[model samples]
Target: MQSELILKKDVDLHHSQDPYRVQNADEIDEDQSIERQLRFVLNRLTPENFQKLVINLINLPLNTQERLNTAVNIIYQNALNEELYSHLYAQACKLMSQIKVPFEHVSSKFISFLSILLKKCEKEFDTDYHKDKYYEYLVKEAEFVTDEQKRKQLLDQANEQLEKAKQNYIGNVSFLAELYNMDLLDDAILHEGIKRLFEKQEKDEENLECLCKLLTRVGPKFDNYKNKEKIDDYFEHLRDIYEKRFSISARIRFMILNLIELRENNWTPRHESGPKRIEEIRNQVLAEREERELRFAQTVPQTQIEFMVADGRRYSLFYGYAHHILDQLKYREDFDRVLGYILKVDPDRHSELFEALICISMDKSDQQRDLIGEFFYQNLKSKVFKLDQFKMGLRKVLLKALESYMKGYKFPKKLSQILANLIRLDFLDISFLKDAFEPVKRDQLCARIMAKTLKLAAEQIGCQNVSDIFELSGLDFNYFFENFENEVDRRDFFKEMRIEWVSTIHEHQRQSVELIQSFKEKLEVIFRETGEEPLAVLDRIEPEFHKEETKTKEFIRALSVVFFEKVLHHKRIDSDKFKKMENILVNFVKEHLDLQLEMLYSVQVLAFHMKYETNFLPVSFMLLYSDEIVERKAFFKWMNNPRGKGHGIAQVFLSSFFEHISRPQTEK
Candidate 1:
């Protein structure tokens, strides 16, 4: 009775137009057997319902080989009928094999069924070949007999059968590839099938089409397998066929050439959408990012999403609304409302928000720049923003200013004004100037713009304070001086701006002199009170010179002068103390540039105190020369045009110093 039911359903499936269509209620109620249930589940398979279908199939009563055979037959027949769901069918077969119970041998069964199905398809291909020949003969005979209607009918039947045969062949090849992709079939089976098609293609163009279709479906996978040499040989054969087969249709020839190129590119199609194409795109993106980083040295790639979650809602404040508000900001009075809106939207990205505000204000009017400056000052003063955050924002702003300058924009006077305002507010200092300008030196235009901005800033804050800032910051004036090729432009610029470069130097010199005097007075007092060694006295008063580089150099020169005086007056020297002080001076000169002139001045001071006692000058000169404390070239250059020629002892000391250096060490 069960066999009869199965036979009845098979007949129904064979006759139905849409074999896998959902059965009606009357048809479904006729059978509740395991075979019927399997048929029902297989017909309804989908990606979303795949797991549920797997569970449903497992729950069916397939406790015997006979029932399992029936279920496998149903799955195979459904897959053959509906060719588009071949991958899903393959996946179902894999899942059933993993069950390890009654379905453990299900894979072997499916493979055997697939083998039989492939043979059946090949037999159909042969049958179609014979039918086409028969039709060709009938058409020719009818044409010879002048039967136009019969010839037309024969041609239509031939075309219809050929198309149907082509679709069935494509579907069969696709199913084989799908099973291979699911690892349910061996490479040997696939290789044999390809070999058979290649041989048949030598005679039949339809076979050639089938061969190309089969290869296109599974070529990349098969080439990547252990049979790469064999695949390569096959492609070589395909190339020869493509070149020599003149009777091949244009369409088939193009397919053959494309397949050859695809294999040559490691199975990566150039214009196709696949994993290899996606990977190539990803690599190109990374390379572009690296180039951008190299071009814009000051900018870093930011990957995090600029959004914040608040009250169960997402607000992309940095990218969307915050920038709009900041850009539209005009008057100072609107600062509070804008700030309120920004804080409400997202406060976590305040640094980025502030940076965006500074960048926007760069191209704005003077009034808007002033508004931003005032906005920053108020927030800074109210302690609503951290100093480090402000510094970070300003650093990024300087980079933006540089980018604008590179594009031939004029120097940003408004940005300079903002910086001056911050300096006056004591919220920013000169050290920030060094930090901001140091990284941009590789770009000369950006460096020059920075110098011009600082010059304009000096205009706002007054030259005296600017001079003091430069002196305290220890920023290299060469950054400013090198901007001009000749001295006249520098002098004219300074004169027109009432920025007395000479006076700034003199003022710093005068400050250094006063500072030296204070140190001398402190040393005298300490020595008088404790009768301590002069080195010990100096050590007690050694300030935190690390805070400033200029002061540190001045302190070292002061120590040199004081020690030389002590050595002259006492008619003796403390070797340990003198060596310690010399080490300090030598290390400082080594670490700094443009200090050779200063060391020369210190040597002159020692000479003046010594007067005609030239014996001690030789040791100091040799130490300076031998240790390379002062550069040797600068030392010789300075000796020829010695300073302080008004003093009689100056000429005498320099003459003797030259003789001492020119003489050999043994003679000394």
Candidate 2:
């Protein structure tokens, strides 16, 4: 689906004016207003169920470090769109402050994101440099460049760097210089670099290519330096040995350029015939080179190969070692003809084809992403492309496409097939699952790939690989356990998913159903007696729980476990029924369980824990039990009244006295 079309439907998603109410969505009952707020965001933002990742983030309480890290990454992804950016950012800002965790402990990426927004608000565009941030951003940008030509293009961006560097960047010039010097052959501007290279005595000999390139850049400048013969001798010696790495045309061009340089400087050579001889050589080389390029551009030669010789006589063949031959072209028609011929003739070399496409695409001034991607689809689709050895194409291609699409970029051709291939090769991991799932909804190939991957992942060994399966499932355990409007709906979905997951992950071994059936019958009567009211009616029971209900069976057991089970441990005596009842309410608060009863339960826990938790009892329970005399009466009076204290019925329960309390924490 196109983004505009999906967004058009987003326009019609009528939301209630009252954001606070939760009307049972898909049979789920959530009390908080944020559930509606979240649903509203997800419906419009997510195009399909696969892309409903905002669902998982919003569904969980964002109180853990791991969840917060995921939130920050999602913030980075959503920042590509202005509308989604504003919404995700606003929610994160609110949650970050609400969580009240330490700022330093959180992911620095999130802190930096918020800092960018804050700076925008304050109208401070210049960010303060700290923690190698500027250099990191530079390296990130550098990852986009591929070969020597691209690096040269980056290096010559000295003008842009000079502008950005005025505001206190470290090693700004050196950074640009590094990219400029990477794999340099022809010396377009190497006079200063050559000077720098010779300044160091213990030079790395392998880097002597820079010296040869320096001669090419500054050879013309030697006339101005007043030691023409000495410099000429030095460069001519270096050229004979090292300049074969450069093209014959590039060498000849330098010679022609040196002649042009002499004329520009109006050099009166000490030998009268020297100037005339140099001019003749320049014209001859230019005419011959032009004729040769015109032929090569019109028709490519077969059985031609580049070679590097080492160990006195041995040679290694160089295929696609140089596209510099074509890059030097002055006419687009000529370049296009040769490029087309090379793709047709040299289809076997994938890297060279990619290089050719990238180089051509980079040279274009308009719509490069679309143009390059379209050309690939039309021309290279027959070549059976696979990801590169290191899998760098996943980042360089698919992710770049995704980022561009989110920013509302339209491609010249739909890239879904290539995108699907990358995903099938495991390029997109779980972290990228949410971000990739949305816009890729349009790409049927990718959608099919995702569905197949998740299906296989469901039955993987040890269930460790099944994390992706569960995450893709998007089924919340707590939602199934407690937050349903219809009891049958909740029970059915919970039972079905639980059984399916357990059996699959455990290799077709279902849990013992007969034992749970026997257990459920014993447990149901007790559960039915304890109604869903504030205080459990403690007139009924004893120390009645069958066992500890510890880790193993707690998760995989039958749904009957939570029915009558409250968190409190109980005893039988009638005198202690109130104690068991009070203990029941307190335990709910401590466990933070069962939303329907949590609010009423918390008031009792806080009130009781405040009075007896320190040493002993409140004044209502006993004057002998009172730990403090000066304010016990006032505390009870303040806790009971509606106008100033609290609600009527709940406060009455909170202020109730218990003759006995549970064991101490240290004893436990």
Candidate 3:
């Protein structure tokens, strides 16, 4: 009866409906039965039972070597479906390898398994081929389907299968890593697998991701192996791929970066601790305990805190904390939080904090300087710190900067930006400007700081304000220029100051001022060389109108004023010269239709300003209208809605001018 039961169990295993079962169980041979039994045992493998399961596998009917080969293949094929148990499968193989088998060892069988897996990965990583096959199958299957929705369903099914294939490929690569980790397979097999992956011509993001996972798993082991140099070369190749391969997705690139960082940190993760040995874990615990003790020692008693403050040790504490805060500051966005910490710790020690901030700002980049300035401005506005503290800090920092400059360290321009911010925030009085220049004659370093400070200050405050401050301080500009060592520096300083003066005007007028200056230079050259009347010289110097219509009109209006002045001085408004000038002006207006109204308005301005000098308004109107330079419609438009309402041109002159143009053709 027991023999019948054993036979019944074998028959049940043979006739079972499992996919790995033979199609015809009745014709199952003895070897097939042994293979089926092996599969059944491996299917139930767990970490606790893996060793016993390896014994059962060894005690099979087949020879020892055949049993090892058959067990390795079954375990590998089962692991592909049970990815979470891959390490268990590897351990089962390792146990079998240690059993002192007669014919062949399980390690050799694992190498065979790895070779099979690498080939499978090569095929699986060829996603293009699988993708093409999927589309081809879809086309063939949906060829006769009339409905679009049905065809789409078939296509979706194919896509699902393709995705499943890709996941299976990744699972196989991970299994290889597990086998390598368990020491069942050597580094050469793992290296071959990685080499095959890298040598593949079409490495999609998924394939590269598989490579990253493989390296992430077994990479650290390779570092200590004999092939460390080869592993380094592989890493170098990965870096090359990351930089040059733009087609890789950002997510995959990030994974590659993480893998590289993992290797760089000696296989330790950045944010989390990796698996640690017993000694390492013990060391970590001891270190943490020591850190807790250090924190306890760092705590100051309330009475001691008061004593420290009374004894002036608070300066040391504040300076240390301030320097630490500056060192850790990475971005401007952290300024508010940093200030809050400072306030919470020692709010009354504003002077020390300010001095520390200024010193660091001078030593760092311009952005750091700007951030510090913004910090000061915000605290001042909130009344968090006294304005007097900031001023005192600035004086101290400036002295230090002067000393550094005297030592041949080139002065940092960013210091001036801090000064500018202080002046703009009213934390520093304009008198500070006068005091900054007090030692200009006595010291070259002071002169350099004063020049840079004044230039930046003028840019922040108005140039007029700076000039007024200088005048009130009794500081002479010529004296400042004479103190400079070279002529070029003096000239550059003068030119920059002049530019700052022009920059202080309204943006609209600023452009007009610059164009007016440029036109004056050209006109002077013409006047000096040709010696013609104002209108003739105006005709000679061609006006390069601005592309913007408003600016061009401004230029025309300004030119009209200068030319009118010249006409008055030379008194050369004869008919022939006036006609020539009129023709030139008319051509300018014609080239820009938008400027026609501007020309008419310019004439009105000239008439308004020189009303007492001559009655050329009517003559100018007739010339413009007769030349068709200013369209009659445009002239009417200007008369209805005129610009420059503050010019105070008389209404009667305009009306009479209009009446004169309205007269009949033969009215003489």
Candidate 4:
């Protein structure tokens, strides 16, 4: 079965193998290129024609002919798939010693097959040729990987290579570009690369482009970056070098991203340049969307409405641009616009979509975020027809918000406080009391809601576990202060509100009640003498003694810190006008000595010193600190009585204070 190997005008087989061939396979003579020659054989891939091509490839001598080498490369690239290329690579390896073709050009032809060897080469890249090829193949294949760990491993190895190259790396741009494109969790390599990028004195456009790509990948993953401080520092560096390095388009895009990073950090763009470029980015990005105004009108736009609603059709476009809309809405708190957007969107959309969007948009750790969510919940109770539909969105948003807490996310202290206020203000519904998700948060929420109701009277608002005012015998000055306005109610309201809080034989309760009444009586006279409001307009934030606004009435108000420790912790009533008030205190006790009113005033004095939280000497000439007046022993003895907590707590507090004040002022 020997066929004559006639030279084909279209195909180029070596004359020895060319000596035997089939007739129809050798027809075309127009093309001269080697790639075209191989493509011709690609067209006639019958079993017999395939046999001839393989036999020729096996029999032909490997030589330095560029045309022949190129034809092999083309065949490898065009017809030899990864499997066949792998099979043929053994032969190519043998032929490489004899052929003069550039290996990179030929190696690239079987790139997918060649990539399998890169991991081995990267591990022991002792030779320059192997290191170069390892980087070459890694750059080509990195785009196809999506596994976080695998990508991380590859980046770690590549960064190691870059480290070996030190400050002057020719392939740095290529290696960094590939690393930038990969999605991974380990940020070590990335953080290091970005640091070195800024540290280098001179940078070209390529370096700048690579940096932008890295930043874009890192920007949205704000929740994932454990070290938020580094993220902030990176943005600060970017802002500093922006005008000098980045182009106008790059600046626009970067500033917009920077603003988002700011929002995630519970902040807004602080710099003037940030705001200006944000305006430019807003206009430019929106203008591009505006180009398709007719398409949006033709049918509902496919674009998802998000924090930035730029199209003007579906989105209200808060502040007329999408630039800093998210953070601005957060800062200004335009809840109506948020509600309006929800109302205007497709009524048929699943409610969770809007719910997730609104919740994720907020910095849940920020207290201000609670106020916005509170606004949504409070408005849900309205009788208005328009607000009725918001029930689902409102409910879903709250559940989603609570779900975060269930996942072990802690609310900030401020947020925890605001939650109590909102719940107390009737901002939540009771039906959610049964969501068995986070019992702790549920109990906390319910406890707060009930506390507002139990605040006035001693009855349980709804929950049995929540404390009732009656249980504490109305000895709670806080509850009594807000609820029992008159002295009779102070003395008598507990028996009427909840009898369980009362004990007829508890004489300790009797004297404590008497003290509270006496303090209130004295406080009223002090209030009258000082007038209702102070005439002086002192800066409320400054320490009372440091203030220059000295008015007689204001000094008395300053003195109110005694009973209202929680209210006026820092106030000092040391003005000359307060001397008359001290005389009143001395004379009042003289008048009420038969009633034994001295203990009540001593207890009141202890309350003020307690507010400072320091064990140091009291800063003002307050009564409790005066050693000449031995009221400390009296207060300690009264605390031992059943009216207050006994167990040497008063002795411990005074001892701690005296010990602290005894130290050197500098040490204290």
Candidate 5:
């Protein structure tokens, strides 16, 4: 029954679906015969099968003389049959030429080893110098064999021996080159191994060490690998270790240098494509911890010489790195380093550095953005920090600082003034604006200069405060630019300046005062019975909407005041009565429509009032444009009717429209 069961087991295993299934379960009972069967398996094996056999032979000892001779015979016969022997013999010749192997025992021990093995195996082939050389190698390997066990191990290691011989031939190159060759040979194997290594939760440290050595040697060359992801992971792992094991400065240096090189330069080495390579390098770099400590550790001390005698040594090694980055047109890093150095110096001594920072900040290069960000953090901190504190409650402090800077003797006047104005506008720090103004010595601040500074400030600091800058420079009210005693002359001058004011928003200062006066008078008329002051009216508006409302009121008051002021200077109308009448009209609009809309019922009343108060149509046109009425055709027909209260509205609306549409595009 036991025999039957065993036979059944053997049959089942023999017919099993496993690709590597053994012939029979009963065959396992004959252990010695199984060993013999394994020998047969080795002898008749194809290279693929031989590869599996080599895996099994990993560390088995091969020092026994009898087994070594047998192993030698088995391998020699197969090698001869496959012509691998000839390949080895040729490789040996190359090795012999590179290395001085003494030829004294040429035919004695060496020939005896090959002679015994070939004869025992009964294989014959033509001899050559290289063939004799291969014979000598086999003889030397046989020295490790003294018994059957050792000999068997040696025979099993024949493939390894052949690999070592080939390596010897290739090892004549530099160490780095040899390592590259090893990398090439194990390319597929290393890639898969590295992939698995990363995939496993617990990787072997020894394996990682081997991987690191290869990575450091290959460096960018790994970029050329088909499985670049593996290489990228290795770089990431290396950076991790660099942070973990190495100093922070070193890590930073590595990371920064790698990023600048890979991103700033269209670099290619082992990587096939430029963009892909840069992307891989960038991903690897950013994967590193960006803490300053890590950076400090990885950073190497750049060359610092007393004096630069050559292009290579002009800067400290770090400076050289800086130069390299700058040459790559990485303006940002260039700015950063320059600012850092500048900031390290005393504030009084930072002028040159500041100039450099300014210059870099002004450049329109791709790297300018990075440089500005870095420089802003490093050198601009002191100026910005103080300015921020001052700007918190008192905007004037910032404005004053910018003014002082602009007015200073050494400042770049045009740029500084423009910069200051931008700062005052809150597109920059008011303090920076003040600082800029003090430095100006230029005879004039042209629009182009102002525009550029505003642009830079807007880009760097943003434009949230740009519109609020009227207080800093006090508007271009230039009430003093011209003189007039005749009504016609005053009117002509007012018209010319109005043209100029419209062209230049900043020069509307005189008009600003007029707007304020007009707004006050209008408010007085609106609250005539209550007798509330202008300030009280202002106080009643929500703070959220106060700024825009105040600015608008000021603009209106200034325009009306300046126009009336000119007219009064020339006696164009009864000045006091004209002002009072204008105030009455403004107050009527404010009371009937502008402030009434706070309540829903009041909003309906405002809509009704806008229909009857046709004189307010021009102001409505200025403010609401097409939105003056809910519907255009209805408003138009109503305005055109001679009997309708909209008769005045029709004239004003048509005049405004034709003025808007017929005027040259530029004038508008």
Candidate 6:
């Protein structure tokens, strides 16, 4: 009977004038329209009766299965009719949410029917009031799906449907918290989707990326989220890795930056107790050995396993007993051996550990007063072994240790000498010294260090003095300004050394003149031909120079005055001479006259002016302007009415008044 019915339905479908008419058996839109109508019929069913129907549909034969799927799609389409869509949409949502739909065919058809209802609701109600109910159905659909591909497909479809329906969702922190608990979405997708989902709620879920982004966005508001426990939890994992290495290196630099930057992190256990808290951090890290360590066992990359194992063992041993081990060793031999192992294995992080230890010792000098400086000095020396690139870090550590030592004792002569030499060696990095020594009468110390460093650097390189040091160091003239201040002392020092002091360097004056000449030569060659009338020919066949020698000399002299004297500040050229040169360049015509003139004159002048202000001249041209001239000129007039000034207005005015005006009548 089912086969007979299916044959008739197939014939009827083929004859039907619908867009979903099947060309082949599998090509029908069974889910979109047909199943919708069937679901409507199913919804008219009583709950117990509908459950029985779904159960019977599970055991149906292949032909019967196709017929039932067709009927469900038909019901789905029927629900979209004005009379039936809402009723069926509500019914389908209720049925799908209640008991798990056992059969994939029935479940798939029901989900399609529900989706149609959602669209219909959106169309009719013109709001997403129905979206929460719709999303609830999708989540239910994800749980009941049996086939993996179908499960994934259904989950993906559900998520997309939820996204479209998101505006209708109840945006609240509670909603996101519930969604996370459900775990229906992948971590990355959930991260973004939940952010959108809860954006209207004005509450962001505090995850790693979200926290970092939040910290960046609400920069000053970070104090609100700066919970000590939260920060402890964050570093709690890496505390073992951090402290075991025993050096304040770049590894934890950003973490420390964050800790120092955020006001609430200022009260962290690591900040409070220093090395002792680091021991607690190590203990916390070791606690992860069984639970967290085995998580990577299956997925550990084959090439990294051996390396990771060795590192893990060393890290574990150092972290597990660093406090007890470091304490038992009263002598240098034991400390050096342990420090050597850490430095050799992973040098980057050992520095942070060392810094933490130093902070601890600096804070607790009363307990073990005499040993702190020696321990710090020995560790500082060990950390730098075989690492030439970290000389700067070494310098900082040495300076820090010196400051710590100064807090407790009288200045020992031998130690002071060693400290002085280290400071002098790194005098060029004066910024570090400034940071380390700014708290005391270190300016005198700074001057002594500077004088000593410059003298030593000069001698080491076979030079005579500080000036020779700069010259032989291949530093540019700016180096003097960079190192020395514009103070009376620096001025006196320069004078004592018999060195020249100028406001700027006319570094490119010759090049500026030569560049103008190159452009002039190019233009002259283009117009070198003869037999053109000067006054009669607007379109000239020869060069525009009236009697070549007179024009060339006038052009060169005027250009040289502007290029060399006025611009380069060799000596001030007469203002009338500069104006004449500017007018000459502005009036000259070639294929691209404006561009060529700009290239030859204005750009060269601009380059010269940039050189003069930046390197050579103490006073700028703008600074030298007269208020009377500015008040009289059209330049200020146009500046006051920029929009009213027509396009190319400045150029037109320059051409009309400046370029075309005849000079004063003198002795012709």
* Model 1 steric clash pairs: none
On lDDT, the stronger of 2 and 6 is 6
How much is 82 displaced in model 1, in angstroms? 5.5
Clashing residue pairs in all predictions, respectively, total 0, 2, 0, 3, 76, 32
Q: Which stretches of candidate 2 lie over 4 Å from their true place?
A: 1-102, 105-112, 117-503, 506-517, 529-543, 546-668
RMSD of each: 32.1, 30.0, 31.7, 29.9, 33.8, 28.7
Candidate 6, residue 14: lDDT: 50
Off by over 4 Å in 6: 1-155, 160-577, 589-668
- Candidate 2: worst-modelled 10 consecutive residues by lDDT: 420-429
Off by over 4 Å in 3: 1-36, 62-73, 96-139, 270-668
Query: What lDDT score belongs to each candidate, Candidate 1 first?
Result: 0.59, 0.36, 0.60, 0.39, 0.37, 0.36
Query: What is the lDDT for 49 in model 6?
Result: 33
| After superposition, candidate 1 runs with Cα above 4 Å error | 1-85, 96-158, 272-668
For model 4 the local lDDT of residue 241 reads 65
Q: How close is every model to the real structure, measured as TM-score?
A: 0.33, 0.22, 0.33, 0.23, 0.26, 0.22
**How would you encode candidate 2's per-residue C-alpha lDDT over 445-507 as one tens digit per residue?**
233333333333332211322432233334322321343456575456435434334223433
User: On residues 1-668, what C-alpha lDDT tens digit does candidate 4 reach at each position?
Assistant: 22445443356646685476654635743334344545565454432233234433433333324444554454433322322223233333232322332245553132222232222222322233224655556655665789878877777776665454432232333233332333312467567666765564243333444455446434545324485788778666666666464543565446546655665655533553323434345545655664465345446554543333433543323222222233334422366665565454455552444344444434332333444445544554453213323435435544544556532333323233322322321212323222321233333333232233343222212221122112222223233233334656544644433432333323432444544445455545545555433332122222333334222223333334332332232453333444323433342233332222233434434432343244322333234334222243344444334233211223334544544433444664
Best by lDDT: 3
For model 1, residues 618-646, the per-residue Cα lDDT tens digits are: 55665667666777656666654434311
Q: Model 6 reaches what TM-score against the true structure?
A: 0.22
Would you list the rank order by lDDT, best first?
A: 3, 1, 4, 5, 6, 2
